[model samples]
Every structure is written in C-alpha cells, then in structure tokens.
Target: MFYMSSGNDIPIDPDGSSSPIPDIDLSSILGNTLLIGIAIVVIAAPVVGFMAWEPVEEGNVKVVKKWGAASGTVFEPGAHFINPVSQSTVSLSTRPQAYTMSSQQGDGNRENTDDAITVLTEDGLRVDIDITIRYRVDSAEAVNFYKNYRGTDAAEQRLIRPSIRSVLRTEAGRLPVTEIYTGEGQTKLKAAAQETLQQDFNEDGLILETVQIRNVNLPQEYAQSVEQKEITKQRKQQKENELEVEKLEADRKRIEAEGQAEANRILSESLDQNVLTEKYIEKLNETDTVYIPVGGEGYPQFVRNIEGGSGQNSGQNTAQSTNSGSTNQSAA
Candidate 1:
C-alpha cells in the first residue's frame, strides 16, 4: 500500500521506503512542454513564410515553372505564394533595351575591338557596318520568347545580333556600295534592314523598336574614289551654272539690237517727199549749192550772191555736181 508521509513533498510505498516519482511536479512539466512547443512554432513561422512567397518588382514578371504547369506560366509584379517546394520563379524584365555594334571598343554593347559587321556589296566592295537595335520582349508573348531563347540575354545574342547581321548583309547585296554612301541610300538600307529584321523579331516574340546604322566604313581606296567623284559632280554643276548666265547675257544683247532696229525703221517709214522739200528750203541760205530731187535722185543747183559776190565757187560747184545720192532735197 502507498501511504502519505509527514510532508506533502514525499510519499511511502509498501515495497519501498520512499518513492521520488510521487514527489514530482507533473502539472509544471506539462505546462513547460506546451510553452516550448508554442515557442518553436512562433520562431519557425516567419522562415516558412519567407520560403513560400516571392516578391516581383516593378517592370518585371516572374515565370513560375512547376512540373505539371504549362510552359506559359507567368506571374505579374507582386508578392505571390509559389509553393517553394514544387515551383520556381524566374524574373524577367520587359523594359526596352539597345544593342550597339561598333568598330571601336567601349562604344558598343560588345567588348571586342571590332564588333562591326563586315558585308559585301553587290558591286563587290567590302564595308564594315555599325548598327544598333532597340528591342523589348513582347509581354504578351513572353512565354514564347522565353521558351525560344530561355532569357533576354540569349535573345539578344542569338536572335537580335544574328538577325541584324543577316538582314544587313542581304540588303547590302541588293545595291551598289556607292548607293549606301548617300544619305537617301543609307535611309533606304536602314528601312529595309529594319523591315526584314522586324519580321524575324515578330516571329520570335520580340518587339523591334528601331534599327539604326550608326556608321559605315569603306576601304581606303574606295573612300578616296568617292571623294573624287563628288568633286567632279560639283565641277560639272558649276559649269552648267556659268553656261546659264552666258545664255541670259546673249538674250539681253539680242533684245537691245531688235529695239534699236525697230526705232530706225519707224523713223524711215514716217518721212515723206513734202517734208523733204520744206527741210531743203529752210536750209537754202546756209549753202552755196543745193541738191534738188528730180526723180529718185538729186541734182545740184548753184545759189549766186548778187549783193556780196560771196558765193564765187557756186558755178564751179554746179558744174562739177551731178546726180548725187541725197534725195531729201527738192528744187532749190
């Protein structure tokens, strides 16, 4: 039999002198275990929470890939529980970006000294083309883009770079290299390149904003030849301008001569025989001899000075005079 001892802290059993189990605080032990479990739960809650949810930032989307999930799985910008045990998230940016290929290092997206594209023109000239591409992932087609390239970086290297190179080469082969050297031709080339590359971009779920030809470098001899050709063209234009001025001067001289000849013809047509006889009588006292018109010609008539005998040579002058050419005088 178990019996109570003198104090409540100890008890006696029939087979043993004392029993320590009877003196143990059972209520306290139970209470301590419950508190310890509560503490463990409180400590582990935050850690589990962190592992369960992902935060997506602005301008970014998360692609959650799970075993049973379709390839089109996506998550927008926000905190979302993705079940850390089974699903994974890849953050992708949708902002526009640019890729510059250039011949000089540090001037382009590439680190190489000469990352410019080397292409052959239809005219069989080699040129280095520096181009830039502005692009972005199509948000609606992000899944397809990711599936095709796995990431934006891969898309730039494999699709963007290669497509630009291929399209530029194709366009360069369609025309002479001299055409590409002109502003309008460069514009045309850029348009064709952008158009062709845009098709490639669209098929691959990428958006091509712009394609720019930053620079084009021809071989040294070709560059010199182009410069000389431009000089020749300028010279030809100058010569044409000079010839135009000369033509205008010749027209002015021709007009002046025509006006003078027209005035002389009008004067000759206005004069008559009556006006000629009056003019000859008005000048009779000023001359020793006069020309009188008989038919279409003139005959000289001498004027004798009776008061002074001043006109001494009038007779000699009349003897020598014959049919002169002055028809403006009448009988005087």
Candidate 2:
C-alpha cells in the first residue's frame, strides 16, 4: 500500500489499500502570528545561546562559580564564554575603594547617618572619629578570597570594617585625648591604624593603599577646656615675651649708661691741671677784652695787650706828671 503525495507516491503498507489522511495546515489552525513567532525563536536560539559569553568591565575581575561554590575559574576584563546554567560570574572590583566612617550623611559606603567610629581615649573622654581606608581586592588571590569570604561585600563587611575599628580603637586607647586631637601624635595614630589594617587586609587578599584620619571630634566639654587652656597658654607666652623685651631694653640701657660713664672717666683723666690751664688761656684769646679781671695766680691784676697795635686792647690814656720836669709815675 502507498499514499499519494502532491507530486509523488509514498509507500505506507505492503499488502493493504492506500488511505490518504487529510493534512490540515498548521498556519491556518494556529494563525500566522504564532507561526512567525515560532520561526523567529528558532532562528534566534543560536544567537541567544551567546548569553554564555559574559563581558567584564575595566578594573574588575569576574569569578565564575559552579553550583553554589567558587569554581576556581577567574575571568579578567573583556568578553568570556561561560556556561549559562551551571556556571555564573561574580564580579569583584580590583580598583581602589574606600570604606569611610563618617558623621556626615551619605558620605561613605553606608547609608545610615552618623556612622563615625566612637571610642574612648586613655583619658576616658569619648571621641568620635571620621576615617577613610583605601584598598583593592588582589585579583591574583581572588579565588582564595572568595573561597573564604564568598564575595567582596561579605569580605568587607566581615573583615575590613571590624579590623579598622579594632585597630584604630586599640591604638587610640593608648594615647590621651590631648595627644590624639592633633599634631605629631595624631599622625602616629594614623600610622598605627594603617599598619595593622594593612596586615589584616593582606591576610584576606586585599591590598591596603592608605588610611586617612580625617577628623577627631572630642567631647564638647573637652574641646571647651582645651580652648581655654590654649588661651591661657597664649597669654602666658605673651607675658613672657613682654618680660623678655623689657629685659632686653634694660640691658641696652645698662650698656648705654656704662658707655657714658666710661666716656666721662676718660675725659676726666685727660684733663690735668696743665690741660685746664691751657684750655683757660686758649679761651681768653677769643674775647674782646685784652685783660682778665682775675689772673692765673688767683691775684686781682689787670694786664693790657703787650702789642699795642690792637687799638681796642691798648688804652688811649698814658701816665702823666702834674709838675714839669719831674720824672715820676702817676697812679689813678
């Protein structure tokens, strides 16, 4: 037996009469839209199969996990073909990231407000600190990191956050609030936190880049006290500076007085009796009168000019006798 096709005959049975079954058109029964939809899906199946190929972004590494666990397969940045069903990628960023503990809203990885680190100093004053730690996942050991911590978020939440607070608090408790507030001591605190956190991050396949102690906020009472103390210290320094200036002035005055006394002593030593007499004689030459009232010998004798050429010094009157031919000196 055989069946008749549109253009040929097809055999069905060997010793029976041929029966032709009616072939209903699938497009007529299911409609053209459904048929077109089936054809599109059939054609697009191979293209959609490319979902196995995952593209990684820059500064990131993708860890392909099998089942629910890490498969030790890591993919670097760019397109990679991965199994769609059993295998998937967990992207881990190798770029620098920061975990900041701050008081300001939305300033850190956290969403809640006022998440700054609060701890006590050696002096027992409560301190709230704002700090930021920079680090990156070591891509080489990313598999091992995921094996232990499962993911980057879990690693950060479990290890890095707690380690930062622990190391910072431990270091801070060693110093008093005054030292921890600023200056070289504050620098030391940052260094200590960085060192310890570095080790902790290294153990978890994370590279610690930097640790920044942005702000150290002390209690209000302590801040006010410190301000008052600073004010007093400034006043004390001002007073000391004034005293130093006064001491320097006194030293200068003393030096001037000593110089003046030395000058007077030298002048007195230079002037002997002969020097005094010479100075007094020299002084008499500049005057209008030719004779002095007092003589050098302390006697009251007046002497006119020896050279009579100066008319002012020489007197017009000469000694005269009243009687003629009498050789006598007259006295007035």
In terms of TM-score, which candidate is strongest? 1
All models, RMSD in angstroms: 10.7, 10.7
Between which residue pairs do clashes occur in model 2? none
**Which tens-of-lDDT digit does each residue in 1-332 have in candidate 1?**
66664756566667767746646899999999999999999998888888887998888887777764534778787779877777777777888889889999888887867899998999889999888888887877777777788787898888888878888888888879878777876787799888887888888878889888888898999899988988999999999999999999999999999999999999888876556555676785577566454322222322232112324365454344342323224443
How many clashes show up per model?
0, 0
Off by over 4 Å in 1: 1-20, 23-30, 67-71, 238-332
**After TM-score superposition, what is the CA distance of residue 128 in candidate 1 from its true location, in Å?**
1.4
Residue-level lDDT of model 2, residues 1-332, one tens digit each, is 45545765654566755556779798686788788899999998787777687999999998888886888888999888877878888888899988888988798778778988888899887898889988889999888787778766787789878988888788889888879888776798789888887777777788889888888888898889999999999999999999999999999999999999999999999987666655656765565333334435333222232322424332231211112112322211
Error of 2 at 174 (Å): 2.2
Q: What TM-score do all the candidates reach, one by one?
A: 0.63, 0.60
State in Å the error of residue 316, model 1. Answer: 43
